[model samples]
Target: MYKNSIKILGAYGTKAKGFGTTSFMLNRHTVIDAGNLLDALAEDSLHIENIYLTHSHLDHISDIAYIIDNYFCKRSKTLNIIGLPQTIQALKEHFLNDIIWPDFSKIPLENSDVIAVKYSELYLNEEYHLDKQTTLTPVRTDHTVPSCGYIYKVNNAGVLITADTFSLENIINTVNNDMQIKSLVVECSFSSNMQTLAEVSKHLTPKLLFQALKKLKRDDITLYINHIKPSCLEEISTEIEAFRGNFKPIILKDGDFITF
Candidate 1:
């Protein structure tokens, strides 16, 4: 692993027998999403204090309930769940509303006075310093649900994450304008043959993805691709190779490290 890198804990669009869903580990104490925390880190998941969510989707937020449930008695620090306003609301209303999963926000840890979970809302393009060395900024993205991508920086170097989106307009402009961002993690979720379904679901196919990247004015930025549907992996990989013109995008996998 590099000294400065975003570890790919889970790099698939959906779960399979072996593949994990979306998640990225920023540091020992922080992660970008909760999809595969328990599976990736096991008891070390107890060290996680923050989860910066991209959206309210199941594949992105599934492990939140399990992580809290697994470490409820062992955890002392509150698990801070941060995201956009609507993302927070959706987690509270539909997912963790006490009907499906226990609302850990209301429950205190056995060892500490702090609640098991906490929520923080994000505003787009505003930078929030998480610690002395790290700053994260949210950016808008086009998805079926209200979602936001993240630009995480450390030591003045940064990586942009476009979690799950169909549109690359904001992404291209962001990378072109933000010199701090040296790497971009984009999603390519479907094959070229499934263009209609990808469009309808607000995901990107290889054909659409490269076609959109044709508008990217910068060539210095490294492109990393993720969130590939397990079923379409082979087909999508082939299409990506065929269509990715001058952009050499490395397809990401579980446990990969993306250094900015």
Candidate 2:
């Protein structure tokens, strides 16, 4: 009877007029990334209690500043910003150091002793309980910066989200070892024509994605593709369509919801 749901707030690798960058809300309290969160959640953004960041990239952590600033006075509780040690350090030093954006972690909220923000550092492969039925485990990912993907388990059912990775070896092995993983949300940021850029940026092209998927032993799991660049969406879509594999990959849109 354990239920879990994920709403895709933003699925693109880059933002445009109609497209947004990577962000997903797990149930109502927890969000997987911060990109486009403000735009997608609007006033409902105040409901977010925790943000589990995948990396220190701007596209993944941009909304952290806005959310704290916008809801500064109204917030009753502190917002928990969870991520790896390096990721947290990067955010503190570069993004929210009071030079670029105010460090809300040190600033107190209106008429309260509670601070506006709090930082929690998570270790790789360690399981953190989200609720009585849900837990999140961070696994390593191949990215330009220090990054990792998350495996969210709700009772016996689980979903693996590969956040902006170039290699799939670690994720495939994680899936093979963990029996609970029943779904995957992977990223494909470029078309096959831009394979060089994909490699340099440590993101996946459609061809690269297929090559990685071929290594996955499970066939019953749902494969959800996301983080596509808007300019190359058409080309990536065509390439993904041409890729005939055991599991058909579904390109996730901003508002798509999946339950498990």
TM-score of candidate 1 to 2 decimals: 0.98
Local accuracy by lDDT, each model: 0.92, 0.90
* Candidate 2: C-alpha RMSD after superposition: 1.4
Candidate 2 TM-score versus the reference: 0.97
| Pairs in steric clash, model 1 | none
Best prediction by lDDT = 1
TM per candidate comes to 0.98, 0.97
User: Which segments of model 1 are wrong by more than 4 Å?
Assistant: 1-3
lDDT of 1 by residue, 43-136 (tens): 8999999999999999999999999998899999999999999999999999889999998899999999998999999899999998888899
Q: For model 2, which pairs clash? A: none
Cα error, candidate 1, residue 59 (Å): 0.1
